[model samples]
Target: MENTKKKRYVLVSKTVLVERELWTRVRVAAAIEGETISGLVEKALCQYLERQAEKYGP
Candidate 1:
C-alpha cells in the first residue's frame, strides 16, 4: 500500500551501485554533517564551483 501523503519537494533522484563499505562511509559522513547524502554532495560541489570561479574571476 502506497501512502498518499505529500512530500516537501523532490531533491535528487539517481541510481548508483557502490560497494557496501563505501556506502557505509558516505552514510556516516552525512550523519556527522547532519545532512542527507544528497545535501552533502550538493554543498560540496557548489563550494568547489565557487572556489573555481574566484580563481578564474575577471
Candidate 2:
C-alpha cells in the first residue's frame, strides 16, 4: 500500500482596502481568468517576489 498525504498550510484572513475602481478591475480579471481574487493575489505576489529576488539576490 502507498501512503498519500498532502501538506497543510495555515492560512490567515486579511482585510485590504483598495480603490473601488482597482477592486473592480481585479474582480473582472479574476473572473476572466477563472480564479478567485485570493488566488490571483497570491500568484501576483509570488511573481513579484520572484522578480525581486532575481534583482536583489536570494
Candidate 3:
C-alpha cells in the first residue's frame, strides 16, 4: 500500500543508460573528483535543464 502522509523531498535512486564510451569518460572524471557517478550525472542534468529553460523561455 502507498503511504498517504506528506513528506519532505528526499533523494531517490534512478537509472540511466548511456553509451559505454561516455560512461568511461564519466568514470574517469568522477574518480578524479572523488564523487559518485550518480552525483555527477545529477549535477549535469540540473545544469542542462537550467540552461535549456533559459534558452527556450521557461
Strongest candidate by TM-score: 2
- RMSD in Å for all candidates: 11.2, 14.3, 11.1
In order, candidate lDDTs are 0.77, 0.80, 0.76
- lDDT, model 1: 0.77
Give one digit per residue, the lDDT tens place, for model 1 in 1-58. 9999654433234565565666677779999999999898789899999999999994
Roughly what TM-score does model 1 have, to 2 decimal places? Answer: 0.55
Clashes of each: 0, 0, 0
The residue pairs found clashing in candidate 1 are none
RMSD (CA, Å), candidate 1 to true, equals 11.2
lDDT of 3 at 4: 100
**What TM-score does model 2 achieve against the real structure?**
0.73
Residue 36, model 1, lDDT: 92
Candidate 3 pairs with clashing backbones: none
Per-residue lDDT tens digits of candidate 3, residues 1-58? 9999754432233555565566678889999989997798888899999999999996
What lDDT tens digits, residue by residue, belong to model 2 across residues 2-36? 77864443323455666566777888999999999
| Model 1 weakest lDDT span, ten residues long | 6-15
Stretches > 4 Å off in candidate 2: 1-14
Question: How does model 3 score by TM-score?
Answer: 0.65
2 versus 3: better lDDT goes to: 2
